[model samples]
Target: MDPSDEGSSGKRSDGQIPVPAPVMEKKKKMMKTKMVRFTQAQINNCIAYKEEEMPDYDSMPSIIEILSDDLANCPQDYIDELKTIDDSREEDKTFWIKMQNEIRDEREWILRQCFTKGYAEYEVDIDDDDDEDNKVPARVAAPPGRRRFRNGVAVKKNLSLSGGGSVRKI
Candidate 1:
């Protein structure tokens, strides 16, 4: 049977009811929302916000008391472990102090090398035209120590806390 011919069911041969495509089911659209990026500045702002909004420090001792009580409830073995950890930390601290001293000594050696003596000399120009004898009086030479490193690097270090004269270097 042709689709153009009316069917005995009192409808067209096409399965659709021909009612403007049933309004297309309204095409339920998904709502899109923007994704916000979190930055360090924004996090810092949030931390500072509570500083202005939160309560004062009057209850600090009470908070400390509560924390102490909570800690007191912890097992003895855990406290012993904490003490052991602290002792181990002290051992490591001594090692670190030794290493720091070694580094400081190395830096001092480098500074000494940078300011070694006998590495430079100084000269002064003399004119014979002013002397009638064409020979000038022998100029008193600079001290031997001064002449050797006259143009070498010099440094002055000042004491920070105590009131005293500074130490000079050459």
Candidate 2:
């Protein structure tokens, strides 16, 4: 075969068989992360609902939808915050990014507390005869050396009951 005819014969000019094109890997869609904010009133309402009904895991999506609808009808405080962040993005990109991340984290934590942990805080006593007293609020007992706060925040301390050297005199 004519060496110049390699192009027509599907062969490389170097007398080697041509290899097919490498399979193109599919590109994955990148998820856009958006920050969501909640007002104090909305948060209170969600907490109240959680405490009153205490829906199970299956109802979490419905609870989230309710909160979203409430937010839609409420004032635009969250939108204002988003605008502020957007405005500052031109001046300081790093600070804006950090603030955005902090806002996202805080929003996630609030949702988790209101939806997941909130339901878990109330224990359902199925066998108890007293219906009014059956719904007991759960409490996390702290470890021997730990102290739990009223809001459920815990802190570890080297406390000595014998009035020993736990506290150092500076």
The number of the candidate with the highest TM-score is 1
Which pairs of residues have clashing backbones in candidate 2? none
lDDT scores for all predictions? 0.49, 0.53
Report, for all candidates in order, the number of backbone clashes.
0, 0
| Residue-wise C-alpha lDDT for candidate 2, range 1-170, written one tens digit per residue | 45555565554656565656669997544444444445567677545542122224333333334466555666688756655654654456465567667766655567686676442222233433344446678898857964543454444455677643433333
- Give the per-residue Cα lDDT of candidate 2 at 153: 40
Which prediction has the highest lDDT against the true structure?
A: 2
Q: What would the per-residue lDDT of candidate 1 be over residues 1-170, giving only the tens digit for each residue?
A: 55445444545435644323244455434444443433446434433442122233333333334456576878878767666654565566576667767756654544444347412222344444344446668898776654454355554545677655554555
Please report the TM-score between candidate 2 and the true structure.
0.20
Alpha carbon deviation, residue 76, candidate 1 (Å): 4.0
lDDT of 1 at 31: 44
Candidate 2 ranges beyond 4 A from true positions: 1-91, 119-170
